[model samples]
Target: MSEQAPHPATGLSALLASTPFARAYTHTALAAVFAAFAVERIAGSVALATILGGLAVLGVGILVARRAEYSLVRLAPTTLLMFLAWTLTTVAWTGDRGRTLAGWVALAGIALIAVVVALVRDTLQIVRALGDVLRWLLSISLGIEILSGVLLDIPIPFLGIQGRIAELGPIQGIFGTRNMLGFATVIALITFLIEYRTLSVRTGVALFSVILGGVTAVLTDSPTVFVVAVAVALVTAALVVVRNAPPERRRVLQWVLGAIVVVAGVTGYALRSTLIGVIGAGTDLSLRTDLWSTLVPLVRFRPVYGWGWFGPWAPAEFPFNYVNAVLRESHASALNAYLDVLVQAGWVGLLLFLAFAGVALLRSWLDASQRRSVVYAWTPLILVALLVDSLFESFTLSGFGWFLLVLCAVRAGQSRSWRERMRSLDGPPGGVETLPAAGGVQGPDISRG
Candidate 1:
């Protein structure tokens, strides 16, 4: 007997679930959203970039929903939701209701995109995609520098290329600020190195990526970038030690290393004056302090509810405007993520933010130490970078920073949440297993990682 033709809906469903289609869909979706991370720099308008990214996210989301699988119960980490709820509630009390609503959309929309991306792609896939994206962006930055500095001998003011490459140092790439370029390279370097260790990309490609990131970091001459680089290196070494230890000893080593980190932080704070000058970050530190001091009166006024959540301080807004006017500068953020949170959302909000980050970092760090593959290490290492850098920059609060923060939290939760512990109660004998994020995909064995 002859078979009847398949229905269009069924045919489309099968195609979407197929391996090749799934691969293509994930790659296209990730690439589009990642590009939007810096789309504002290219388009020169945050609103435009937000609108463009939302459209891209919606398009990919609709296409993937045909086959995508997710549970509302497990869509995102609970701590993250708590923090978001706090931010949402701020809308009820904030003076500028319209701006707060707009700000909330930017914060929530990017987070939603991060959740969707995590739902579709596996860890190795995410690292590889990010590695590829950074390589392209860094290369373009260098190419632009060469063109502006060597050929044109003029600044590309529109995109913030300062034509300083001919001078051989302190050049900002397409990110518009040298510090931002340096920060991006620091992350790129970490991603490239992890990608190399995982052997997820070709050896030559990985080596080239590392070099590109390294070269960009040098050209930017950003002190914070160097500090972040050193911090990442230290964490990498500690993780390596823990990872190579016997499985039984790994837990002990983790505690020992963590204690050392605490001691180092204490020591660093005690020697702040000497360390600042020695590290040549004095200028940067002082600038941040000046901006931070301006927040006292504003924060004192609200103290608990904050002046309200303006992710990036809108110059035209009431309290934010007053702050800049006093400082005699146009500062978008307090420059410290913690302080920024304190001034915007108050002590209560700050505590929630820390709790959200703390839970994710602790979970991801434990997972990395216990998991066998080097790929498992990426999440914790990236979290360390983000958290350490947050001390100096408010990048983690909005835009790409917020996106990454949520992405890591979601990834870590999927791999090592309490839910897995409950699941193990029913399905497995002694070990916990992470349920597949979506159909046709598998998750790592938790074994309590």
Candidate 2:
């Protein structure tokens, strides 16, 4: 018998399913929203920020709900939930309860969004989304800075433009800080490298991004960029080489690497003063030591729970007064991610965050090494950059760095290597034998680096 014509609703559903909206539009839009938080700074308008954040959160929820079957039983979810829960609890003790609540909501929203992206998009889509967003953000920022300097001739204070208009920098671009611009440059360079390596875009475009990022970094005089760039390069190179090595050589290389790490840590710790001098840093770290010295002792006052997450310093408050007196400038952060966490969340929040970061990094590293495609490497590389940057800057709770962390954590937790963990938990069924695998699964038909 001939088949009956399909129902109208069924046909519409099929057409919708075939559409590329989810593949092309959704991920890109989500990335743009995330970038806006950093690029626009949401103009510190709580209402605008809330609307944008809500949109992102809603997008993630919708996407995840559309999936046929998905698992939330993963490391990323556990760690993030713990972190978010702790952050929310802090509102109870926070001096400024309202701000603390806002901070918690923002954190939770991004974390959930990251999890959704990880669950829905594969590695290639993730990279593409990141590349597209950064390409636009960095490019627009560079263009604006040039315009403000050359044509406007008026300092764009909001964007942090100042000094002689002819000078290349220290231009803050749309990021509002030279260091922030530097950080964006580093991320841009990495994203462009991935795009170039994957042949996802024309070679010239990727090369241009690299060159632009490099030039911006130089002009900005962001020392952190140089340090982070070198570190990421070395680590990436090591990972690539080791991943490509034969099984036997891989084992030896890992041991050698471990030994090197141990030696380097000891050496770095022992000669930290000398190294700082070599890097042209004073013992006081350009007056940062003074801030640290003041804050460290004060942490003892609320050593267990912290003063509270994202605590706004009331003028007469103990730590705020002390910090402002020493720095001679109003400061929001301790200028160190670890210290910020310790000060805000106390030991409990710090420990939870550390555990969260550790799990994410470990999972991402494993996935990168196991995967055949180099695009996977971006996850760990970005994580490494975040870790390195956090040592000098308090970006852990900020927008981009935190967003990247959540993204990486979710990606890592859901990587194919993680499937092995599931298999371990529920071993092969009786009388069902598995055949040897041919090779690692291909990633999105993209070129292998």
Candidate 3:
């Protein structure tokens, strides 16, 4: 018998799998780990979640060190450091020291993961990674929803279905809440739209994913998510149109935008009640107002640094217990991200976070406006969506959403850092050699598109 020779295709597969491109799988896996934690009910054992997170952290640590730039001063903005410092400092004042310490550990872990992602993967790679993860996650959730709602005749409460599993549902998919699933769907839809616009090879698949994600959001029956999705879609389209418009019109457009925003704000204030009813939030945000009414008084106890972060409530545990007792509910958060931050870290932390978000949004938006590539647009759009979502959901406190926020902030900060460096080098501008203008988020890989 002739000796069997190794197949060329098999060798090529192995070669490709060993390259940095193959890190897409690792990125997807990291996302899955974060999703498991985010969708805790469906994620099985805590130990499994920890192990997965650990492995991903280790893998990403190694890869980031090998493949990307690493500098604390360059990558970590002052706002970020301030936030971390405040969070750590507050641990000292937390009532349940152990619990707060544990929380800090988890928070640090997530922060490290964000650094790894932002530093190692460029903008295009980040988009591809996000696309891979969203496609996988949405597909799984859709499959499970079909199994429970269509065929199984069983409610999988962990997966967010309850009673009457036979019909198409108010299913939450794998996210544990209808709004969460809807939020995820909105994000996936936007990402896939961007991907479809930029990448020709998988345009059909991306479009189909966008459709599936949109349908899932609609099925979730979350008015907030549906409304925000439409708003974001419109905003994204408008931004792209403006970006491609003649450069001379850009400044005029900016002035027009500012005027439009002022008008919109006035109109919204006048029609506040009517708009609230239109969105089905009811007059009181389904009793969130009541919850806030109760919680706001307690924030006065330590107004400057209200309560410490780390635990579910303030340290000394006086007012939180009282609030929970009064509400007849074991509430973990204020149900609003900003309000929660104010409660936990007080005015100082809240201000730091706001500055961080404001700077990040401004920089990312500027980059998106200047860059022609659709891939460069995701950062700003995602930031806008999250900012809108944060009003209704406290997702910024944890999960992949928080991780992405940190990543974008770091990237924006890095871009600003590079630009500043160029500016410093070009001091006394006459006779100085011209330096390359700092590029946008679109990485070198985007040229292939």
Candidate 4:
């Protein structure tokens, strides 16, 4: 019997059908939709609807990954270990059971998603999915902001807190608080900046949304966010310039620019009261000092196991309640995210958290160096921003921050995979190949062939 040839389209069709990329894309799209609806204040019902939709997409992704023959190294077990530590700490020491349970659920969901990504043959699919989600989020967020601004004059009675200040001009969006909108806008802007080189038309729209979101952020009058955004932009621009410079010159320029930034930041802090006003100066310094004091004692109280997962500092009821007081006498410095974690989870928890972040950062750097991908270039900048924001914000506790971390991890994994593939193609160490010389004479190749 004659050997049978495969159909011409069989491979192509199989490749498309078996790829994990499509499943990842679907999840990314759904996540973007959910984020958009959440930001728009569309309706609590709508928010619930999207959450359910995301869960459905997640389920599909899980199923697809399960059927794949190849798999990436799973990071979920490590994540689960950290989560268990957090849960034990929270349960043992935390004052609020309800808040701890919520944290447990959120952490569990994040771990599940990480597992889904880890079980796939191509980790790039997860990175692409996250990129898609971010792009959609930026566009939808901008559109909602613009629409709310245009319809500001007409208010709906049932919208509650969001409706009262809906008429505040082009910057407020559907969100009543300017700071919240600004925070969200900054994330979108950073995402656009990072992905600018590879952006398509859809991404361009997302970038535009970032600009509109920035306009709203400016309108909010939240000096801290404004300062952070400006600082991030300046740093990012400087890094871009350095990256474009000749290799030798780039090193020199980095040192000079870094010194300038440090000096400028310090000088600004020293004169901040005179330049910005006493309230701003006092507010900034006081929060850090208070947080330090509060956290030091709390961490000492539970140095080993720490408070139960997400237990100690419930935002609804806090030991640092003076933060919400009109007099503002308590000058507590639990303003730092590290401090918040330390207080709630203890030193042990803090160490675990640091280990997780360190692994992510190290992986990002290693992958970028090995793969020469631009995503790696942007990873450090985003990581830096996350670290800086954590100094004054509850980054880990925020949905946006966790989402960003997950995106970074996915990109890092993709880069690492590419590096491994390249190494495999390069052949075994110290191996040599026999080849013909330029004049057609046979010779053994000596250049690590």
Candidate with top lDDT is: 1
Stretch of 10 with least lDDT, candidate 3: 428-437
- lDDT values, one for every candidate: 0.75, 0.69, 0.67, 0.51
Model 1 poorest ten-residue lDDT run: 429-438
- Expressed as tens digits, the lDDT of each residue in 324-366 for candidate 2 is 8876977767778888888888999999989888888888877
User: Per the 3 Å backbone cut-off, how many clashing residue pairs does candidate 1 have?
Assistant: 0
Q: Estimate each model's TM-score.
A: 0.88, 0.84, 0.83, 0.65
The ten-residue window of minimal lDDT in model 2 covers 428-437
Model 4, C-alpha of 315: deviation from truth (Å)? 5.4
Off by more than 4 A, model 2: 1-44, 163-165, 281-284, 311-318, 416-449
C-alpha lDDT (0 to 100) for residue 231 of candidate 4: 66
For residues 1-449, what per-residue lDDT tens digits would candidate 3 score against the true structure? 99998898666544433436446544754565447634466446575557547755664544443432233345456777788888778877766667666666666667666765565556666666777888887787778777776778678755556633245557676677777778888778777876776663265787788788877887777777865786687668768767987888987886776588678778977997888888777833766777798978878887778567763354336567777788787666676788888887889989988988888888887777776666667887888787778777777776666777787787666555453464454332111111123322343331112
Best by TM-score: 1
RMSD of 4: 9.4
The residue ranges of model 1 lying beyond 4 angstroms of the native Cα positions read 1-38, 41-47, 50-68, 422-449
What's the lDDT for candidate 2? 0.69
Score candidate 4 by TM-score against the native: 0.65
Question: Can you write out model 4's per-residue Cα lDDT over 1-449, one digit (the tens) per residue?
Answer: 99998886665445443445446434653364335425445557456445644654554444443333323332332543674556655764666667677666655555444434433423223334555565555455445554444456353323222332244532434333344455656665665554444342255565665565565565555655666676677766775676567766865776788699789979987986676574354565665666566457656656766555652245454544534353355432355667766766667677876776666665664443333234445555555566666766665443545545554554454434343354455432111123221121223422111
